[model samples]
Target: MGAPGGYGTGFALIVVLFILLVIVGAGILRF
Candidate 1:
């Protein structure tokens, strides 16, 4: 628990990017 803020920030960013990628991927597949 030395740097929870830093770790949480990175994890949040990865999760957001992953969700965005999934959404974009589905959109491409639909078309």
Candidate 2:
């Protein structure tokens, strides 16, 4: 059976959030 579509989208969102968190943490450390 084929994989469900929502799984891909959810995974992408999680990745984006993780990247955003990393960027924010780096910015905080720069100060």
Candidate 3:
């Protein structure tokens, strides 16, 4: 079922992952 809600959820998940990766990278660089 390719519903509109599914797309929105997937996009949100990707965005969250990207933000987390950025934070982790910054922390590693700080060390």
Candidate 4:
């Protein structure tokens, strides 16, 4: 699974983006 699991990075990036968006939304709501 050397180069076969390269897609994991893309999925991880997407997850990170989602978390960031959620955090930003929470901050906006709090203000």
Show model 1 residue runs off by greater than 4 Å: 1-3
- lDDT against true structure, model 2: 0.93
Ranked candidates (TM-score, high to low): 3, 2, 1, 4
The segments of candidate 3 whose C-alpha lies over 4 angstroms from its true place after superposition are 1-3
| Candidates, ranked, lDDT | 1, 3, 2, 4
- Tens-place lDDT per residue, model 3, 1-31, is 5669989899999999999999999999998
- What is each predicted model's overall lDDT from 0 to 1? 0.96, 0.93, 0.95, 0.89
**Candidate 4 lowest-lDDT run of ten:** 1-10
Best by lDDT: 1
TM-score of each: 0.85, 0.85, 0.87, 0.79
Error of 1 at 24 (Å): 0.4
lDDT of 4: 0.89
Clash count, one per candidate: 0, 0, 0, 0
* TM-score of candidate 4 to 2 decimals: 0.79
lDDT, candidate 2, residue 4? 83
Candidate 2: stretches off by over 4 Å: none
- Which residue pairs clash in candidate 4? none
